[model samples]
Target: MPVTSVEKDLNTLSMTIVADFASPLQRLWDAYADPRQISKFWGPVEWPATFVRHDMATGGRSHYYMTGPNGERSDGYWEFTAVNAPHSFEVNDGFANEDGTPNDMMPSMKMKFEFEETANGSRMTNTATFGSVEQLQQLIEMGMEEGTRSAMSQIDAVLEDLATFAAGKGTELQILSDTQVRITRVIRGTAPQVWDAHNEPELMKRWLLGPDGWTMPVCEVAQEPGEQYRQEWENTKTKERFGFEGELLESAAPYRSVTTEKMIGMEGPSTQNELTFTPVDGGTLLTLVITYPDVATRDMVLATGMTDGMETSYLRLENEVLASAE
Candidate 1:
């Protein structure tokens, strides 16, 4: 998502971003919520930031300084308005001193970050409300839009690296070594988040086929061996349901999970999938390996345009996650 001052009201500037990455919503949220990952990419390349006092709470404060390009330097402090970790965060941005005194010279502003996951990807909204017309003008003069676009590009790089890195490692859930179709995907979410995405109807609707008139029902989940998960996809237009079931082949909460999924709509043997998640430096890296029985089915899936689809999806997810983190 290109960062444009897409919407502005009064003296406030607002922007919308979409990021889709292989990662699930939870891990993406954590990266944004954590102070460590945030300090890395918060500001521009010229304005490298360092966190001084980061107490992330409802009334907490985050005071950071940007080493100015010229002799001019500034320190900013954010007073938390709300801290809904992994979902939404809003703050009051005010220039402050090292001693916690607000700098009256700089205008006060209210900044908000909201995250939402959609079927195709995830979307983020950022709003910065300036104190006066002068402050808004200052931001425009600074070329905020271009600066934001550059920052977002860095975000895309991070997301792509995370996806490729996760896929390169991790254990196979289904373990179909000799299968012809090499259904390989790195799971990019925690075991619990993935489990919820696969289990909960509403959450699944957000990122799945809900908007497209596809219904997934008759779904079940087994936490242990022999535990079964059965789900059916019903085409709203045709009124046809393709029932699918998978045995809980492996399960590790907050870590990894795999299931053998079999669908009735598609012919041939059941497609087995193993979803793996490993905790990396800052967040979880996920890989999902899928194996189809015959070459025809594999060809069909490859022809379905999944590579592009997944790329777009993952990019959007990453963007949204990183945006909300800011």
Candidate 2:
């Protein structure tokens, strides 16, 4: 996750993980195949995870990404290998284009998952082989496996919770929580310009929201607590409007604004939104995070194509932010 503009001076560890769970082979297989199932145990409990497209079949291809607790992103490709169901499958994977063409520059690897019925339940064996021995060794030296195992433990816990939830077992959504979303992004713009792009109400309307027709109707934002922002979201094609009344959770001028969003006609747990700006050469790196209180609500928002909407908002912000590079 991106440390907010408040923690501008602190360092955060961005980690990648892999894990296996003990469940029925078909159950394990379904988690790898279904987007909704993937969303349930996809990440660090606070963030959101959603699939872009998935084709699980022999020689078929897929692609998906995850957004961080703070709206950071990471996505990769889906390659299918040996796809006999309830048995074994493998893939040559990496961040890829919609067509499943891998990003050649990024580290790509081979992943083989094996599922077998165990006396207690089932065993899933995952092996990720990096292309180079150096890379593999490098990951090992950095304790990659340990982190992967921890994340997997989280996955296992959630799976158990899901089982309970499925069997009419619990009320609280806490039983299942995993890291959600992978992050991928970069920013380019002077710090001041970027800050303006995020904080100025009218400015945000132009690039971040769109023309007045689809833009936020009333945006009231304060860079500090006890403040509020009256922002409205409208559908460009359908004229559907969603309203958000938010209290400034935390505000650091020209750096960040964190808010608690309560959207009209939507209930459950309210959503928390945060935006941060960091100065980079010739620009400021902007990070946006959306956190949901429960996995079910998070899943619902993700299913609504919230990630795509957020991406569009960020791109617009970048265009405006970059205009002031000097």
Candidate 3:
């Protein structure tokens, strides 16, 4: 168990947990920074977590849910108040509704996580401040302390599993649920460079083409929130064309963007795509969470070899667009 100590102060209306890890500072930090690794241990062993949106920056928000053994789910949200990279971060944590909004009936708490280099490896101090002593007592009675202990106990496994989430793994896909999926890849470039490749029309046209035979003839990029963008591709030999159009719902430059996407002529519900970029050890970690309208729609889309096509485009982005810039 990595948890060294747990403290609760009624006078201060706070609880603090300190945990030490054998992994290096960056490794410990990455375990939390990367959603793939964090999702493995954020919740207790019995109630595993699935993060749909994790933006680890100031003014950002994260939406995740824990699934119980019997298919029950408890949603949560984190509003990041401060982020100092590998050192520390603070968030307002609270229960969330299915629609990713805060639940006002449930009490929210402020949490600060501080990381530091220890003699053997690293240490993380987590402090949660409740609004009132009654709130603190209520959470304690609800097994918050025990739950946190169990959650932190599982982190050791995630921290040591370096090979699984490391760079060069190519594009990886995780079916988060029936209606949501997460796609992640580590591109060989900085976050800004990767974000530019995604937003700049010229750069996107060069590398966003999924396969070798496809040419992006029309690339109308959206520069801000509420703006609609269109993308079309044509086969080189057959000239067969298809396109997608969407409105940018949210934009956090160089870090995150959320857009609603749909086939140009299709008459069905659209998908909300949330993209996040984080600077990692090797390069930039690009995570895209797509929320489908239903299980049937998700399955239909995955049947089209979407992940494989995405991998091809990512490889091209690294080699053809980013590498040439170097």
lDDT of 2 by residue, 101-156 (tens): 67776666677777777675666666676766665666567544543443354555
Ranking, TM-score, top scorer first: 3, 1, 2
Error of 3 at 325 (Å): 2.8
Quick one: ranking by lDDT, best first? Answer: 3, 1, 2
TM-scores for all predictions: 0.45, 0.42, 0.97
For candidate 3, lDDT tens digit of each residue in 54-91? 99989999989999999999999999999998999999
RMSD each, Å? 18.2, 18.7, 1.2
C-alpha-based local distance difference test score of model 2: 0.56
Which runs of model 3 end up more than 4 angstroms from their true locations? none
The candidate scoring highest on lDDT is 3
Off by over 4 Å in 1: 1-5, 11-23, 69-72, 160-326
Lowest lDDT block of 10, candidate 2:
1-10
lDDT for residue 156 in candidate 2, whole number 0-100: 58
